[model samples]
Target: RFMDSAKRLPNKPMVVFEGQEWTFAQMHEWSNHLAHFWIAQGIGHGDIVCQMLENSPDFIANWIALMKIGATAAFINFRLPPKALAHCLRIATARTLVFHPAFAATVDAVRADLGAATDTAPACPPWATLVDGAVWRVHPATPPPPSRTAAVDFADPAMLIYTSGTTGLPKAAIVSHMRMTLAAVGFPGMYGVSESDIIHCTLPLYHASAALIGFAQACFLGSTVVLSRRFSVSRFWAEVRESRATVVQYIGELCRYLLQASASAAAAATTDHRVRIAIGSGLRPDIWEAFKRQCGIPEIGEFYASTEGTAYLFHWHRAGAPGAGAVGYFGPLARVMNGIKVLRVDPDTHEMVVDSQTGYGQVAAPGEPGEMISRITNEPHKRFNGYFGDASASEKKVLANVFSDGDRWFRTGDLISVSADGYYYFHDRLGDTFRWKGENVSTTEVQEAFEGMPGLVEANVYGVALPGTDGRAGCAALQWAPGHPPPDADARRQLAATLRQRLPPYAVPVFLRYVPQLEHTATLKQTKVALRHQGADPRVCADPLFVYDAGARTYVPLSAERYVAL
Candidate 1:
């Protein structure tokens, strides 16, 4: 499909990076040259090639070249430490690795542990090569032999994208060629993207959102994509205006950062840019309307899907808001055709609650939250491909005899509630929900409430283990808005009073920590694993700590003695 599109629209601009544009013909020729170079290096069909380059035109070209030669590209997160990088490379088992010069120090740090196969000995083939200016400089100027991508099977693995590894070491998810093709074609139809549209993509190319949805969709539609090395709140609008982008892609945190920037910075930013649609995931409900209104975006195309999940939901809000705070909308026809089920489960154990008589899981009633499980059929596209090189993890995601004797369903690991009008809203992740004061508490819900408070830029809510406590206690780490001082005594008292009135007593946070900034993963998702591990110990954490003072009706500083007394 990509090659056909390139042939049909050779002169159309396909990629714009760092003030340079590459037409479809130019991109095709460049990729063909690199494809011939890789074929010369003995890379064949079914072989995996690991990638650790930043977002650039070279990264996109290399990916296209690998696809042309029928090789799977394993995209490693560039920010990974040496230990984690080695683990990912070992799991991939790829014979060749390609990277840019900017990451030479990182590659050198792990060179000793890369094994003998990657060494430069004459007896063994070279396993690692730098693609900055040397490899592409030597490639032939002509196109490669007739296209080999056409002969590739749809079910064949095209890429290996690893998870965020929040719980443990990252697991490689197998993305098939058919799935990539579907994202390229399906997303354009979902947003009504046209050939004249120019998409501004600031997300990292290593993520599926930027690679498959942003880049691939532009290619499929014969449109233009404005690429950035990474997302920057300061330069986002400026770049969009300069590139004349009609569509912008974003993650939730990126939008929050934009909202938290100084009014002067935002005032200087271009709001009259040609951005008609903004599309991505992770937009919180509290700031959804505010972000659109502030940025002058007319439409929002929010979608819900993971790298490994088989089911997907696309919410198009071109008209007035029908499904507020919903990841997607399900019409009467969609509800019947998709057959999505929300099954009740034990929140603490995360096990399905089964009926004794029927011996099957019971579905949740309307307006009740439950774990969503989508039925899988014999169709190839709907089949869950499972994780790469990990059968045990893959089998854990499949539930057998879910509704009937031989029925199979794919567990989404997400808790969602459906309204009476068929709108689906995300509640929280399966493990992120915790029990506090004999009631269930959702971290996302708490985080959303925190976003509405004044002077708070970002909030990360998590349950932390406490001594002499039956369950985990709620702790919130907050980042103040830029140029604003930390909360004072009166400000803290007001915040506590507001939260008490807005939320249940059990759901209200018990402890608060103030920091200048919050850490995030490479894909721009706020991380909580490390914060949860650190707990609320002042000796372990460098951030300022505060304890809720029920008697004083305000938050007080936590001294060493005060921490132990609680």
Candidate 2:
């Protein structure tokens, strides 16, 4: 694809990064040079090469080089700590580890654990190489000798993208050449992106969103991608305007942060970006229309997909008529062709609601939330490659004999509801829904409600354990809007009242904690595991903790005396 695009549009800019630009020809030549360098170092076809670098031109070039040589690129999260970093490296079983020099200290910290004598030669032939990506741009400009080996196949694994590891250790998902190609070619056309489009990509390159979707789309369309080292809400509009990007990629949290920042920052900072379309997932209904209005971006291409999942949902909000939060709208043909089934399941146990007669999971009724399961098939496009080196973990996501004998389905582990109009709405992750007062509560719904309250910037809702309680109670870690005072007595009372009106009694958060900002995973998803473990204990949390007073109908600080009494 790189060579083909370069041949067709040699002068067209392929990547723009911090004022530096790389045309299709330039990018292809650089990648060829890097491929030659890797081959000279004994890296060959079918070899695994680990990469730990920030979003940069070198990262793109390295990925292309690896793909050209038929080597699987294991893109590692650069922010990982020593133990996790070591684990990922070991699990990938990569013959070579090429990382940015900025991460040299982190690499050295884990060197002993990596079972390597030195950083350069990790007791292996093709060893760890630390390259200063920003400074080291030297590589042969000509293509390397063509391989006498077998041609690369679409079924070959091209990359290993690791899961976010919210529940446990991150599992690497094998992304095949076909999958990458489909995302690159399919999404651009699906989202109405063209060669004239310049995509602003601030998401991490290590993520599938940036690499497979953003970069690959640009490659396939012979378009341009304006790259950022990382996402910065304050710098977002400036970069977009400077790069003259027509479309921007985002995650839900990024949009929330941008909206929150715009509320306080100067209007000129965000007013006039050339962006016409914003694409990605996790934009909730509360912020959807607001984001489009505030940012002046009319089109929102919200999609629902996971690194390992087979099925995908694309919500094109081009002719938007208040469909703020639906992930996607499926026509009758798509409904049957995709084979996406919503099966009823026990909220508490998370087990499928099996029919006694058929011994299969029952399809959920319309408007009722259920776990989404996609049919698995032998076709390459519908195949699940499973997690790398963990067959049991992979098997856990597959449901055998789900609807009929010998039938298999991939468990999405997400709860969603379909309306009579054929619109699909995401409820929450299966694990994020908890029982409170004998009723299931979706943290996403509660969080969205809280975000609607005045002066609230963000809300991270989770269920926390309470002594003598039957199940976990709802707790919210809240962030105040910039320049706004933390929720005062009156504000807290108003917030409580607003939530009471918007949510059911059981769903209303029982406890509230004012935080400066919420912790997030690498992908910017809210992290709840740590907070859930700490519960409402004031000793563990320094934030101003408050509990809802049922009698008073307001939130009051959880003083030590009240804490002990509870």
Candidate 3:
């Protein structure tokens, strides 16, 4: 795709990673070199290559390289410990682990634990071993001599996307090249991106909708991009101006981060901003208007999409419509299905219900809240490639025979309502998973990880809407069982150390809430919704919320001064 686009306009900027710019032609060549070499090292199609990397130019280069070999690429969470990394890689049967030099120690930590793939051949080839050291004498390998090629069949699996569920474990969703291409080609047509348009990209490359989709689109559509190592609201607008960007792209909390970074600055008058439009999901209802007003951004076009599902809802036209959570994927024949056939049903059973006010037996009408589902079991346009090797998970996503026998559908697990005039509105979510930092956090998985720790009883966790954050921050209330108040500070410190060792740092709760007793429902399931809503209010449940201080690398009292730093 990059080569074809470059041939059309070789001068167009294809990437700007870490302040370094690469034209379309250069990106394509680098991708070709990486792809051919990996394939030559015995990596084959259908194999997974795990990359534990941060946002960088190399990440984009590696992804395209993997695609050239028709191999599945898995983007592992950089925060994952050695054990979790081994489990995911082994499960996917990853053939090659192409990673940056920064993670040499991470690879060392997991090398022995990688025995999970004992009988299988090597999945990741060591780079240094592949090339002998005489760097000064040898030149970088040249791109392959011109070879024959054909159009990328839309159905080919371009990526195997893994999402951390709020429950169970991470499920790998297969996205086709078609899915990536459609978003690139369709986004511009739908919202207008051109050669003259300069977009600022700071999202991590692993995120499907943001990095891959946006990166591919910019290259294919002849748009210039200004890349940053990570999102910094303090420097966001400034970067846009420096890059002469006309539009800025973002995710849910990124915009909020900008808004909260400096409210007074956002409120300053400036219509001549390098950014005329910004796009992303999770623009909070409460902060949406104020953020736009303060930033002087005329448009805040938000999109809603998930890794597994097909179809996308561009709330570009429906900005501020009270419901805007749709960002699955863009495909042909996709629609909001505002009329009949769109309905919500009992969780236990698929049977539809009638209106509560009137006994009218029919699917939900426009403006009525119902679970958002799509009819695509036999739909040729969107076919899920099954979660890696987990068939049970793949089957779990299907709603069989909803309308009639043998009619299969994909359960979106999202609640939404369509308007009478064909606009769809997001209501709420219905899965155990909640998003944070473009990654899904499984509450059950987190709770399980917290178990077995000394003095830690039952752990209750839920996503609470933070004042200036998208996705629920994991707020937990811990019970200390009678007479078990951490005998000494030594024990408390040990407890914190145990948690850090067992779980990823991000999975660690920001607020360490302690209490003698934790409230729960009649069924005895620990309830945390209210506690989460309250956050760390001192006047309310003053259980002494705490945050993990990375510098000290220990949990400390959640103080306002430190909260600002966190």
lDDT winner among the candidates? 2
**lDDT: worst 10-residue window of model 3:** 128-137
Candidate 2: worst 10 consecutive residues by lDDT?
118-127
lDDT tens digits by residue: candidate 3, 1-566: 66678788776677776667888777776777776666566765666788767777677777877776666678876655566666667776776666666676777678776652222223334422322223211424444334312333567677776665344356677777777777778776666677778888777666665554577787678887777877775777777767778777776556655665554463442334667777767665545676676766667667766777754567663445443343322223344341124566543233456557654434676677566666664343456566777899888777665556676666667656666555565554554445666555556556656655555656766665566776667666777756776424566566668767766766665566777777642112345556666776554656667665667766667767656554
Q: TM-score for model 2?
A: 0.94
Models 1 onward score TM values of 0.94, 0.94, 0.69
What is the RMSD of candidate 2? 2.9
lDDT of each: 0.84, 0.86, 0.63
Greater TM-score among 1 and 3 belongs to 1
Predict model 1's lDDT versus the native: 0.84
- The regions of model 3 sitting more than 4 angstroms off are 116-152, 266-272, 318-342, 347-362, 377-380, 432-566
Please say which candidate is ahead in TM-score: 2 or 3. Answer: 2
For candidate 1, lDDT tens digit of each residue in 131-244? 544556588756655555656788998899998887778889899988888888888899888888999999988889998889888767888999998888778898999999
